[model samples]
Target: MTTSDDEEINPVTMLLLDQKDDDVSQPNNNSNIINIAEVVVPTAVEHQSYHLNSITSTLVIRQLPSQGLSFQLWPAATTFVKLLDSYTPSNTDPFSLTVTNAVTSVNCRQRLRILELGSGTGVVGIAASAILGADVTVTDLPHVLPNIEFNADVNKNVVGTRGGGVHVAALSWGKVEEMEGVGREYDMVIGSDVVYHDHLYEPLIQTLKYLLLGDGDGERVFLMAHLRRWKKESGFFKKAKKWFKVDVVHEDGPSGKSRTGVVVYRFARKDAVFR
Candidate 1:
């Protein structure tokens, strides 16, 4: 559904009541966005484990709700982990099946290099590093880097064993300097539940523009995993479509009185040229 028309959501913040759910379809409780201002943060530690077929044990991540939204795990991140776990050079399901010459073709080029935006708790990015054996950089605001670093360090054994590595950086979206520093060496960019705050739409777009329309050859893909909470999120997509070709590569059915589940959208340059 994209929750199409006009309204939409993402910031992973701003009036959203962050609830931890295993099966996104069922919420333990329902709360209005307005009252979310009073949402309580549990001091308890939040931990999640993702088992990787390539690794002997599971990848572990710790969430600090007391620190704020940036420290918590979001629903869309889980969806990305699911895809990364089963990714392969020959598998054509989501990458090739829906996105055409996206993922499957990318593996033939070189070692996969991925950049992740707003990597809260560093779950998806860490998982991608180990499972795909792709060198990955996980970035977010300056404050969030420590925690991401912690998670990355904790799983260094797994990443190193798989021949992939994870790097943590501080990237505040919309900062030209930060964007330029990150560079465009990556073949793919990924994010989950990143489009939450309407105010950040332009900044997020600017960062995307710099990276997707970057210097290099071949195709560069941006895969964003999102769960639409408000109809206004359409504005973000509307504005994004103007700069890049946006397509929904994956979607999960609506859960817990919601009309849409986590949706993974592939963004590429309309001309399909990275140079």
Candidate 2:
């Protein structure tokens, strides 16, 4: 959903969440009934022309990628692409580089298990494994996995030629029951440009809590990149802080208009001593 920069409310956000679920006739959880309207305005950058261009000519693109972008954005069986004819290759994917920097700064080990949520094109996770040598598992919805797999398949070749591990799977963050006992918790969890809708905030947080490793050698750190929008209130970050010590470790902009172009958040489980 979108609005003119000056508008106080975004009708698009409300409309995006208003449609009834297609599976409504089937039995479902009551919690699923909550639509996007219940939450405050969503804070996310509209991808615009450049972000899509990053992958437009790469290989595959989605017809209507999840981001709020135009028809020039290509939708595909897996990865989405849009032409970035104007932007330099370095600026083509701002979010991807942000995640890469976070993983590198943390000194993630190549041998550790790593998980990535909403790995749209699998860029960050794959790059991390390639650079750090970590065994990576890239995940998204079942529908999104095939494309992630394709990306992983390509990365695996790059890494194997260089000696690294890359894997892909289907993961819906809030579906904890399905994800239980999959394996040991990951040492690092990475997400890029993922938080947008207010309705998904609680569920996304809950899912992270469930998957995080809290003890032993399995420490977990979650890093996310976002382009701040009005609906993305500080309160939302505060709400997440209750579960983990949240910090806006990095911020940069012209992501679009007056809004910050890219922001990096690092979160770790809060300790009692610190509190």
Number of the top-ranking candidate, with TM-score as the measure:
1
lDDT of 2 by residue, 157-270 (tens): 545533558787777667766466344356667776456566778777877777653465234567676555555455568788887877654555441123334556766667
Q: Scored by CA lDDT, what does every candidate get? A: 0.76, 0.50
- At residue 247, candidate 2 shows an lDDT of 61
Give per-residue CA lDDT, model 1, range 1-275, as digits (tens): 34454454333352232344542322222222323469853355656666776465577777766678888777788778877776665665655443334444565746568899999889888888788777899999999999899999999988877678999998999998998788878867889989877899999999999888866633878889888777778789999999988877788886554556888998888876421
Give me the runs in candidate 2 sitting further than 4 Å from their true place: 1-110, 233-235, 255-258, 272-275
For every candidate in turn, the CA RMSD to the true structure comes to: 6.5, 12.4
Clashes of each: 15, 18
Q: For model 1, what is the alpha-carbon lDDT of residue 185? A: 84
- Per-model TM values vs. the true structure: 0.80, 0.59
